[model samples]
Target chain A: MPAIEVEGLTVRYGDLVAVDRLDLRAEAGRILALLGPNGAGKTSTVETLEGYRRRAGGKVAVLGLDPARDHAALTRRVGVMLQRGGVYPGMGPAEALSLWAAFYPRPLDPAGLLERVGLSAVTRTPWRRLSGGEQQRLSLALALVGRPEVVFLDEPTAGVDVKGRQVIRSVIAELRDEGVCVVLTTHQLEEVERLADRVVIVDRGRVVADGTPAELVTRGAGRSIRFGAPAGIDVAGLAARLGAPVNEVDPGEYEVGAAASPATVAALTAWLAERDLPLADLRAGRERLEDVFLRLTATGGAGDGGQR
Target chain B: MSSSPAASARQPGATPPSAARQLTRALAAQTAAEARLTLRRGESVLLTLAIPVGLLVFFSVVHVLPLPAGVRRPVQFLAPGILALAVMSTAMVSLGIATGFERQYLVLKRLGSTPLGRPTLLAAKTLAVLAVEVLQVAVLSGVALALGWRPGGDPAAALGAVLLATAAFSGIGLTMAGTLRAEVTLAAANGLYLILLLVGGMVFPLSHLPGALADVARALPSAALSGALHASLTGGGPGGGVESWAVLAGWAVLAPVVAAFTFRWE
Candidate 1:
């Protein structure tokens, strides 16, 4: 059975429907990244799964128990790192981690967890005095201290510096390798690309696209050829010759889609040579995750049913 | 790092600790942390400990208020009242305001999502309040004794009064903390503390007040606490007035129920 299952889940704040009917699942030993813009209901959906917010309608289960009804039992198996404000401002990171560790039956050693999160240097510094990146790392440590079977992290690397981000990335990778189920929400597309095994993109209270990163980029928008050329080039001439949709995205950068084949490439080179239009650079690749996300979310309603 | 028990504990077939053991450890850890936080805050110390002790000393040395007909000295008369005031401040005002800010900061929201259940969290907070009150009582009693105050009542009766007052005040405090904004709770708690300090018959006798206000004071939990403590400490009997005990008992039951129903973590 999956570690977490949400079917037809809906959450509303009075007249405002924060999360519309949504279905999601995560199995043990995999990392599922929930990506969305601000106010797209990513927090509402995650909070519902964590049992912090009540669901207006539908089912949400963590480790086979209803999150809302079985919160006391479910919390033991799942750990959560909220976006902000969990640690006491005056308490040092060491103290905070030790206290949180004690909440679990077989918790990680506080000192070791602190060192693992790269917070050993600031172990004695009060939470209020720590930098934002340090605070995020400490929060992550608190979540991992519980030896949770499943973990949910919201914006885990929001303000983290490069080194701190690496520490968090490695820790999350370790959690996945240990056969633990990991679910996280982040706006950092690069982080998602690096860490997430599966990506679920939610927009305006609904899941717009859900699949592996490669599947999303490849399927959402097919392969394209991008190159830089002189502005105001006769893109109509190129389109007539190539017999495919081509547009100049910027003043100098142009993109050719649906005609990225070798024959099209040769034809385009021949066409450019015939017209003496210099191709400053040329690259052929599938769409990046960022491009796919922007297109899917910017279009509002589920554009393509890439659900898996 | 791989040899760490935390790593081994995650392996399949490893036995998870029993639920009862987890609960017990969580409760203890939370209580200790809560107490440490309360003690570390300068404002909490000033309000809960300093102000009460200062009042006890000042009132004991200076005969500022007129005493009742049979009271021999002001120290003897004011000691028990100050004790009640200390209980009110620590359990109600201090706990209420601190909890309000904790909620505002989402500290409670975070902890509420953990394996430590709400009931257990409440129990840990109550335990922390009691722990602070223990120190408050010890320091205040020592000061009172230094100023020539003697207790004439059953020790058990005074102990019972302290426990009841803690319950009544903590319940009311938690109700305020759980329902209102941090700033609002701060203002409301301090306002109630001051009102009770003067009209609840802590420094002044309720008999000295006009008939209508005195009756109102008699019904309040603060006055009930002071009256019960007075009867136990000075009157040398378990009869701190059945009515006062009844009022306190009613508050002790009702306030917690109301708080539990209305409390929000964030």
Candidate 2:
């Protein structure tokens, strides 16, 4: 059964529609990445799912409870790491964990949880004394304190450095392995590509694309191919010779799409061999999720008269 | 949603902590945490304990007011008034300023997101304030006694007066803190404290005020609280009776309700 289900969700801040009609579902033990740009209502959607905001219109269920109606119950079952939260100045990181533990029925031991977030060494350091990355790690611990079945992480690694980012990804991955439904929202394309099992792309308050990473990139977003032609060879002539639709996205950089991968590679290699063209640098691969997001969002914005 | 041992404790046939016990334990833990933080912060500690002591000593030693004929020394009259000010200062100013900063820091929002509901949070805060106020009253009473001041009325009534004053001022303080910005709350709390101290008979008798200001002072919670304290402590002067109690009670009840409605978690 799905851990979360939202049907026709609409949320607005004043006259600005933050989340246009949207639908999404995340099954238990799966990582669903809600990807969107800033101001794309990612926070609003996450907040709504966390029962932090009231939806203008929608039918929503989190852990089989209506978020708007059973907010306290849902909150207990679902853990959330908000983008920014209040930290008391006097409470050390360890003390904060202890206090939060008191609120839950059964919580992770403070030491173990601290170690999990890499905050064990600074357990006694006040929150204000921690570095930015350390504070983010502490916030992650708080989200996991309740041993919640579903965790909602909103930009969990926004300001984190490379190592910290990897730690966050590992933590999310571990949570999923533990049978917790992880709804990860981030603008980091690489993080989504690395961690998400399913991708939900939202733009301007609507879901523009949703599928597995490979499926979305392969199906609609075009692929890229780069190869070296003879020094005197014409790039456009190479495109015609290869018998495939191609475009020079940049000087010396070309992108192409074909129905069959092996056939396309063979055709390109054969064409090069026939011309005694040494393929100095050859590159071919499926389209990236970033390209898919940018193209879909860019196309929509352009179609809507560029207001976006 | 996983059920553990605690879940079994909440099952239909299992025993649960009584409501009173739960409230007590929660209130105790909350109060202790708040109090520890309140004490560790130098600024709040000064505001809570030092300010009251300083005002008491300055007014008692500086001879700020001339005593009426046949009345005891100025310290006798000023001591009870200072006690009322202490309660007002701690409950209203200290609570207001602290809560404002707490709100600004999103501490209240974070707490609310937990199982610690608003009522428990309020109870905890009130208890913390009261604990400080209790120490304030005890220390002030001891100092005043050393200065040869003695209450000339019913002992229980004087204690009752102190308790009432604390309750009333705390309500007003929490209300103002919950409703205003930290900067605005700090300013308003200090400004209101001074206004009440001067006009509401903390430093001198309301009888000494001009007719119009004295009338306003009579309605002020600080004045009512001071008046009640004075009537009990000095056992001489215009007795506050039920009217003063009512004024203080009005503030105590009304402030918190308004605060609850207006407070922002963040």
* Strongest candidate by TM-score: 1
Q: How do the residues B110-169 of candidate 1 rate in per-residue lDDT, one tens digit apiece?
A: 887777888898899999999988998899889999899998876688788788888888
**Model 1: per-residue lDDT, tens digit, A108-219?**
7888888778888999898999998899998888888878889999999888789889988988988888888999999899999998999999988888888888888777
Error of 1 at B11 (Å): 5.4
CA lDDT of each candidate? 0.86, 0.76
DockQ of each: 0.53, 0.29
Candidate 2, residue B64: how far the Cα is off, in Å: 3.3
Worst 10 residues of 2 chain A by lDDT: A299-308
The alpha-carbon RMSD values of the candidates against the true structure, listed in the order shown, are 2.7, 4.5
Docking class of 2: acceptable
- Look at candidate 2 and tell me the lDDT of residue B57: 79
lDDT of 2 at B263: 69
How big an interface RMSD has model 2? 6.1
User: Which residue runs does candidate 1 get wrong by more than 4 Å?
Assistant: A221-224, A230-237, A273-285, A299-308, B1-18, B236-240
* Residue A188 lDDT, candidate 1, scale 0-100: 92
